[model samples]
Target chain A: MTSDATPALDPAVADRLKRDGNGLVAAIIQQHDTREVLMLGWMDDEALRRTLTEGRVTFWSRSRGEYWRKGDTSGNVQHVKGVALDCDGDALLVQVDQVGAACHTGSRTCFDGRDLPIVTDQSVTTDGDPAALEGDARG
Target chain B: MTSDATPALDPAVADRLKRDGNGLVAAIIQQHDTREVLMLGWMDDEALRRTLTEGRVTFWSRSRGEYWRKGDTSGNVQHVKGVALDCDGDALLVQVDQVGAACHTGSRTCFDGRDLPIVTDQSVTTDGDPAALEGDARG
Candidate 1:
């Protein structure tokens, strides 16, 4: 649906995209200065075009099945700082200057305080020593 | 397909996941100290479990239809630093101490030097002034 008949995305840029089965690419938002990941969203060509040229972030809401511009309702604006496509072209990192909360739940970031327990390398000393390797195998 | 008889992921963490149609969640890898995004991968419950307890990053390769552990073949290991789930429980941020290149193309990051042009807020002065707003509308 051509919402406003704005110009399409740059063909050179579009040629690089490797959309998923749903013709969607993952768009990751990060705070420009802090480098903190703010949230993850999906974007199609149209949504990406808007995000790239409108000076704000927009996403194709999978659940809502429609396009939604960030900060339109909640005032949590994401002023675009930069946009980069992954080498595989399946993901985009959109750096922004966030005005307020970046999560739907009003948190500073979607990942804030949501850490999961993970085994770090320091926790397991498998220095290739036969005994340590055997111990790791047993554990 | 339980490859080994290792314990499953923590019940609490497992319950928080919101997998996609492919029974996978997007995992964004970031360099622990630099906070630079390295790459994005997909992980199913099994892959997630392995990553949580294996002290390394693992992903479900959609193209290969199998699980692959990072650095296993490339020798560019991703030593787990931390893992966090988004508020929506549909995405993950995995912080790691990367040993070498994080992309299959042998780049430091999948997104390195792939920036795309984006219009910044400063480019368009929409100060809510009627005249500026009108000008923006025209432009």
Candidate 2:
């Protein structure tokens, strides 16, 4: 495993990254075909480099303080389909072709069945006009 | 503008969150209809509560050290369609009906055109069989 002192990623790519104080960026993994968000993980330059070149998703485990390649132990591999960096360069969007469950709980995706109930604004019109609210004071 | 000392989120939902040392979680925003990832933001309990209860998305600006509601200035509102917590509760997936550009750069998405060149493993079969690699030593 490469240390944070030495970045394995291309200098051009590494220079754009805005890592957190811990020298890590959040990686959001999504299913390429279904477009389902599979999971979220942390990655440093090396882990991002490995995922891009090695064709499999790799993440730096914050709790374990080590690097881990997805599906290495569980056989639920995430094959790289595409990778993109967000505008601010603080996050990554990793599109992959998932082989099996993407969650440790055996769910197809990490966000599956984990919805948090929220009050949807009924005032917003179907055309997505918030100003269309009927007599709403919050306007 | 609620302080971190007093959480505004539902107790049940707040209890599940595994926030970072700074008491923040990564929020991944996606377009509801297109399923396109719009952007990524940080949220503390108060921001999460405002996003859930209010019609629009609210995020805590790490740099500005304040709360901001999406579309307040840019008119690129993100009306909440759904919100979910990742399995580990360290991240959030916020589905919304985006009104305009989601990127500060005026792009449709924060990840728009920011693709990284990576070596895709052509050896992996179409059926997603990693073992189907022919004469590949990395198997």
Candidate 3:
């Protein structure tokens, strides 16, 4: 299905987008596995449509008014895991599996050099293993 | 000198923030090493001051209008690397050295479990190896 599938964006959602200038919301996509942000882009009905259909991340290009696939050329594709809406629904939080570095620059993650520590097993386990106290998280 | 330097917010900066609301801006903190997103929070003059002063991540709670120090209770602290302002100077991109999980739920990163692959060379490497940082970053 395409954005056309939805017929039209919900009026309430459209109203908020109107305040932002048009029927567009900013979507911030992040690498789900690494928690690294891949990219930030705009989304309209059509872009949102392609994202759902293609299984990859797509965005509406405001400057060109065209659909942008995340890795169309760079190969740093973003695979969509889930898309979430902010309380206002005017913004989107896109969770994705990033193929590689998301930025045009040669960085591991779009947030390269941020220098954050790996917190995979802090409280759950002191020795790289999840403790029984934490139980088995389905995740 | 560190994340805890409490400098008076620049007057011009404060004025700009006040014009919009107060000396408050949204800080998008991303993990430096993994490039993962940790969290999104607001920053007022005081929070900004604390972040700069403490050399740790700090944000103003829009809901509470108070300071929020990352990892204060959870040990998922974000060590400040750098701060960038958008053209409007109303938003901040904070690059940090995040310790442990940025999210309260204790995932490796706030973004977890998306599935996209950036095709790369045949030789697979470990997760944090510098050589495999980006797909085409072979050296």
Give lDDT tens digits, candidate 1, residues B40-85: 9999998988887777888998889999988889999887766788
Chain B TM-score, candidates in order: 0.80, 0.80, 0.66
Q: Estimate the lDDT of model 1.
A: 0.80
How high is the lDDT of residue A71 in model 2?
90
- The RMSD of every model to the true structure, in order and in angstroms, is 8.0, 7.4, 12.8
- Per-residue lDDT, model 2, residue B58, is 92
Task: Kindly report, for each predicted structure in the order presented, the TM-score of its chain A compared with the true chain A.
Answer: 0.81, 0.80, 0.65
Sort by TM-score, best first: 2, 1, 3
Q: What is the TM-score of chain A in candidate 3?
A: 0.65
Task: List, residue by residue over A1-139, the lDDT tens digit for candidate 2.
Answer: 6576844688888999999989999999988767888899999999998887787888999899999988989999988776788888899998888888999999898987777766444442322333332223132
Best first by DockQ, ranked:
2, 1, 3
Which residue segments of model 1 deviate by more than 4 Å? Answer: A1-6, A119-139, B1-6, B119-139
lDDT of 1 by residue, A16-76 (tens): 9998888899998988778998999999999998987777888998888999977899998
Candidate 3 has an lDDT of 0.55
Using lDDT as the yardstick, the better of models 1 and 2 is 2
Name the best candidate (by TM-score). Answer: 2
Ranking by lDDT: 2, 1, 3
